[model samples]
Structure formats: C-alpha cells, structure tokens
Target: MKAKYLVLSFFFFTAGTLFSQNKSVPKSIIKQNASILKFYDKKELQSMQKGQLLVLYVERTKTLIKTLPYIALASKPGVTMVDLGIPFTSENISLLDTQHDATDKFLDITTEFQKGMLPYSDKESLIKAILFYESVLKQMHELNEQE
Candidate 1:
C-alpha cells in the first residue's frame, strides 16, 4: 500500500514539473518568421535578375554555413529542421560543407552568378530556392541572439 502511494506521488510530481516547465516558442522565432515573409516575397524574387538572385543566394549560403555551428549548439535538443519549418533533412546538414567549398571555388573565379548557370528559370521555384537559405539564416540568427 505504501509503495502504491509512493508511485502515484512520483508520477504526479513528474507530471507537474513537466507541465510547469517553459515550452513556449521564443519571441525571436516569431519575429524571424515575420522578417522572412516580408523580405522574401515571391513578387520581389521574380523581379530580380538571375545574376542578382544567384549572387544573393551564394552570399546567403556562405553566411548560413558560417552560422550553422553556432546554431547547432544554441538550438534546443531534439530541434529538427521540421521543427524550424526548414524543408531539409539531417542528411542535408552533412552536405553543406561540400556545397560551401564548391560555391567558394566558383566565387573565387568570378563574382557573378552567371546567366547560363541559373538554378531555376521559374520565378516561383527561384523564390523557394532562395527562401530556404534565407529563412535558415534569419531564424538561426534570431535564435542565437536570444541565447
């Protein structure tokens, strides 16, 4: 009878502790989302020249790569790309260094995002492409700043 009471008491204590813990999403995340939506509009992306878009993409990618380690450390445990609304998997994180190296090599030769080397012709597709990197960078910065 005493063991049964103890078990119930422990369970309630754990439940109360978990419930009382702060699990609210940070304010920075809300602000970041707003910033991304405002800045990465599809219409704006559509208006940009391919070369301009490419330069921005490459720059943002490089920034993201540099910021990623701090992001990883500062982020809460079990925070997945899905949690952040980033449409990437853990596997993609492993590939960023390789991608960064290639982009760095390309940038070394020329500062232009060449016309013939366009990643996407469709305006919507281009927005999506740029949106992902920009979103990650913005969100990570917000998260890091909060900590």
Candidate 2:
C-alpha cells in the first residue's frame, strides 16, 4: 500500500507540473515568439511590416487600456493569478472541451500560421482568420502591463 501511494503521488505531481506549464509559461516566451513573427507569414508579410509600424509609431499618451479584461471575458472561467505577471496561463481555455468547440477554427489558424502552411490552399482566408488571435494576445500583453 505504501509503494502504491508513492506511485500515485508521483503521477499527480508530474501531471500538475505539465498542467501548470501549459497554462502559464513566462514572459520571455512572448518576446521570443514576437521576434519570430516575420517567419509566421506564408506570403509576403510586407503588409504587416506596416502594421508593425502602427505599434511603433502609435502615441504613448493614448493611455494603456486593459487588454486582459476582454481576454478574461472571453475565457469565462475567469483569470488565475492576476498577480503572477503572466496572463495567458489561467486566462485561456483548452480548445479540447465540447462547450469550447468554437475554438477549433482559431486553433487551425494558429497551426497554419506557426507552420507557415495552409492545411488547405486558402492562404489569404487563413491569414484573415488569424487576426482574431491577435486581439487575444494583445489582451495578454495588457495583463502583463497591469502586473
């Protein structure tokens, strides 16, 4: 019985660690992916280079708004560790659930963007669909700033 209890506890700990990492991660991850943004595009990303400029040239006095609030609104279960300084962990949902089957289209878009391939040939449509993801990420950034 003692040996069995030890084995079960070990499995639980390992599972918990995996779950935590999947949910939260850390800030360096965002900066790292942001650097790879150029590679995420399949066609000429030159158009988005201009969008990058929108981020750079935008005025500072515009007042930083809460992006995480919108994100938390979407997630429904609400955020975890608003004090953790990393937003995406508890604030995002698993796409695997039935009630959230709505996330499939979004997930498919991300898979295509990251791999730089269209599962189908409709590259433009995939790119357009990817825009919805940006808003979620932007909200995560807002949470980061809030922290």
> Least lDDT summed over 10 consecutive residues: which range in candidate 2?
57-66
Give per-residue lDDT, candidate 2, residue 50. Answer: 43
Instruction: Give a tens-digit lDDT track for model 1, residues 30-61.
Output: 21211222346667888888777776665655
**Total backbone collisions for each predicted model:** 0, 1
> Ten consecutive residues with minimal summed lDDT in candidate 1?
27-36
The TM-score of predicted model 1 comes to 0.41
Candidate 2, residues 80-142, lDDT tens digits: the string is: 334334444433434213323433354445544634533433435444444434444445545
- Against the true structure, whose TM-score is highest? 1
Model 2 stretches with alpha carbons more than 4 Å out: 1-117
The count of residue-pair clashes in candidate 1 stands at 0
